[model samples]
Target: MSNVEHVTFKNRDMYWEIAADIYYPPNFDESKQYPAIVVAHPIGSCKEQTSGEVYSAQLAEQGFVALAFDASFQGESGGEPRFTEDPSLRVEDFRHVADYLVTLSYVDAGRIGLIGICGGGGYAINAAMTERRYKAIATITGANYGRVLRETEGSAEAVIAKLEEIAAQRTAEAQGADWQVDGGLPESTEQAKELGITDVDILGATEYYKTTRGAKPNGLNKTLRSHMGTAYGWDAFHLAEELLTQPLLVVVGDIQGGFGAYRDGYEIVRRARSTKKELTVVKGWSHYDLYDKDEPVAQAMSKLTPFFTENL
Candidate 1:
């Protein structure tokens, strides 16, 4: 096991700071340059949960320097009107983290790779498309937020209606009204059932986020209501077939429902123009199972470790 150090750095081209944890392999030597991996968390999650505690920790143990960081306006990072989930800014955050990694003498700048979980997985793919710094990319239950929103809303008319509502709320806030925040998961699985949220994905999310299994104080699980409209119109996989040329790995569970990761994973694998790409479907596992479940995580790592090793 390796010790992780908590740190913060200014986000380039942005005013606020980004908080992160850097994991060093056991018996790490600063004098030697090592390949590094950037681990990005799911939406409504912080570095402390699966990103840093699980994936980053394991990647470091496998002899690579792994970084897990909070996105610009979420987690411990400094930003105004927090919990904003802007897709463009989220994609840019990966490049900014790569900038920081390159300045470190212990990191081999040319061998940097990425691991994105849930929504972060989608952003990671988008980032890697334009930014060549990431030599390889892997997504665990990767989800495109915009596509998911569009699909789950049932119709384009419904999406537009929601966007209209968001626009009105933003206008109201600009006129000195109080900001409206979206709430997180239900208090418990029972409460979720009562709310009629029976989808395996949402139910699993409630269980993971609301319980001791994956809860962290900074993983507030809320988002600014006004900022969500940006995701409705954005697409994480836009032009992926043309611009995504890096070695790619997509890992997803078999179970499917409200959350679109399972389908999105296959879609990305199908769309990416990467010369070397692979998709591993974890049988019998739901989308959230890969979040922290021992078996699923192990299965994902088995593929990820080799993919990164071969590519990076």
Candidate 2:
């Protein structure tokens, strides 16, 4: 059991207020400082989503202080250009959350850890690389959104065309056009059918984000189209084999015929420099299954709880 409460803090990058939830152990004692961990949500997601709050609550139940936060310019966080999914800023936000964690008298600053879900996982890796304050780090069904985009959208010509489209949007906005939004996954079941989007990875993800299963109004599947280039250039595990020296845990799904998490998690596990690292593949779980659903969560948390406990 754990106690959940709303919290807010500033992002050091620009001092903008970021929204978050603090999950404390059910028997939390303010007089005693406890190890803490930061939980990062997926791209286009908020603190309330499955991977963010769900994992935070679970960790808190295990006697760890957990903080789940919305990235800057998305969810309930304060920032202009709403829904800007900048990788650099996202990575910096993790460190900023760590900064907030250390300020709490009941949080053990030196023993802090981090858990990131989906796209957040990549940013967490980037953050953990230089922010040694994170003694341990982990990502579930992790993905480098930039890399995912590249794989999904083929060709240099296609990329150049996207860049051109974004550039045109920027110009149109300057000419007083309405704020254009770039939607990610389909927002409704009807829309999925209309698009003929049958990819299991995307279909599974939409089920979580577009349906009542894990949907949040403020967390619609959209971001500014201008963020395309930023996401395209940023690499989540930019220096894994070389600079990521912290204890790393990469949990991938063995579902979708084992292509679910392997696409990203396996590569990271292969390259990360952590002498203490583990890549646990959850059987019969698809990429999106890790977001919620009782069985998959149980499978993922079994390993995560122990990993954080042993390391953090």
Candidate 3:
């Protein structure tokens, strides 16, 4: 009924082999070239999570070939000091995946596109700024990583102090201490309540990642607090409005959580150089609802199907 297979390829700069699931539409013909899209799961997640697997699977069912993969240091992908969350490396992963995708005879290189979800929306946009290989890009509940997370939690001075602690942890690891992790998303309903998470978007993430609804062992809800500070290092919007030239479709919930409304989706629309861009807001869904919610996912696909077909 489907033609999905596991595959591996090398990252452009990193030595690790990226793990991916490649999906081909039903009645796929090798003799014919089809437009394709690279789908990115959220940060701290993998191909099996809601954004990656479901997005890729459903898109394939609609006739586009889709590739979903883990980032260099996460999930099934090979990398040391697990859960680095390096934005630059993550951006390159998309390029390298595009490299592998273009080599397929049944794929049209010029028609290549990308779909980045949640935090991945930042990476996908980062790639589109100059990758050139991808003609168009879109994101669902896109998050500008540093702005949303760092702003929600701490100040620069406190982050510096935390960075010092991370330095100590790194030294400790080198001295044979075990790698330490911090739960990035809401790990439980009780924890969510304790954190006083009032944002509906964050609540949606709690329902998906922490619960069985979209849970996967590979999509760890935790990250190494020491080395993973890189996740909060830079904001993705700097120069993005001037540098981003490709068509962009920013699909965001009217309300956002850790991925804030103004910082994530609206900021991109406010600052991208993409002349052809549109922002769609799903009325009732929060950021995480688009991950696997029936209505939101279908609403997003309605946009994705046409966006790629017309742009790529």
Candidate 4:
């Protein structure tokens, strides 16, 4: 196994700092430049919480330079109103990472690629729409953040109403009404348990977000800014359709009921006039199965190594 080093860089006019872990292959040589992959972590989670860091380590062992990063406003990165999620800024963050990577003597600037997990996958595809420098892109168990925000578990009208309520809370806070947001998990009820949420998928997501599994001491589950809602504005489908010049690889668990995102994104890539694309579906795997399991992780890495090796 090769040693991985933790590092940080600045972005967004230096108003923000991005934290990352760089994995160097055994007997790494500065004299020889290598293909590089930027690995982005899941939404509401830091680099270390998800499998982004682990996957980067494996990529390093396979003789590639892999850098896993904590997105802006999360993890060790600098951003106001901690834990606030912004899709546009997230996409720009990926571009900034590519800019930072190309400056390193050990990185092959022309051969840079990206690997995004979960929510990060959507941002990666969104970034590729404008960041042509990225030669290849890959995603695992990905989610289209915009779609989820607009349609998951609630109707569009209902979601808008909830957003409005949050905004009102923010207004009250600005008026110094002694407003305080809950910094912990939502309580589980028997009704939730009957929905197959034995642990944290449905009811436990609240707990998971508040605990060490996905939470940081400075992170927040609620934001006071109304513009935060606007972050989910762009259509990932449109982004995929427009940015099909680069080679892409989409991987998903076939049994996961939420594979629609992967299917839709892959179809866009396949229809592109200039891009070459491939899709891999793992049998009997669920949404979170690829997060840390060794078998699925290994299979994903195997597919990733060859795809980037050939395209990037």
Judged by TM-score, which candidate is best? 1
lDDT string, candidate 3, 208-307, tens digits:
8788998899888667766756766777777786789888999987655656753578779878998989999898778877888889889999998988
- TM for candidate 1 is 0.98
Tens-digit per-residue lDDT, 1-312, candidate 2: 238888888887796899999989988999999999888988778888864568888889899998999889988899988978788888888878888888999999888999888888888888899998999999988888777766566876887788788889888888998778878778776788799977777787678788788888876768898666787766787878899998889988877522235678888989999999989888887878888878888988999888988997
TM-score of 4: 0.85
lDDT of each: 0.92, 0.83, 0.83, 0.71
How many residue pairs clash (N, CA or C atoms closer than 3 angstroms) in each of the candidate models, in the order given?
Answer: 0, 0, 2, 1
For model 2, the stretches where C-alpha displacement exceeds 4 angstroms are 257-260
lDDT computed for candidate 1 = 0.92
Q: What 10-residue stretch in candidate 2 is worst by lDDT?
A: 254-263
lDDT of model 1, residue 251:
95
Q: Which ten residues in a row have the lowest lDDT in candidate 3?
A: 254-263
TM-score to native of every candidate shown: 0.98, 0.95, 0.94, 0.85
Please give the distance, in angstroms, between residue 143's alpha carbon in candidate 3 and its true position after superposition. Answer: 0.3
Q: What is the C-alpha RMSD of each candidate to the true structure, in Å?
A: 1.1, 1.9, 1.8, 3.6
Clashing pairs in 2: none
Clashing pairs in 1: none
Q: Point to the candidate with the largest lDDT.
A: 1
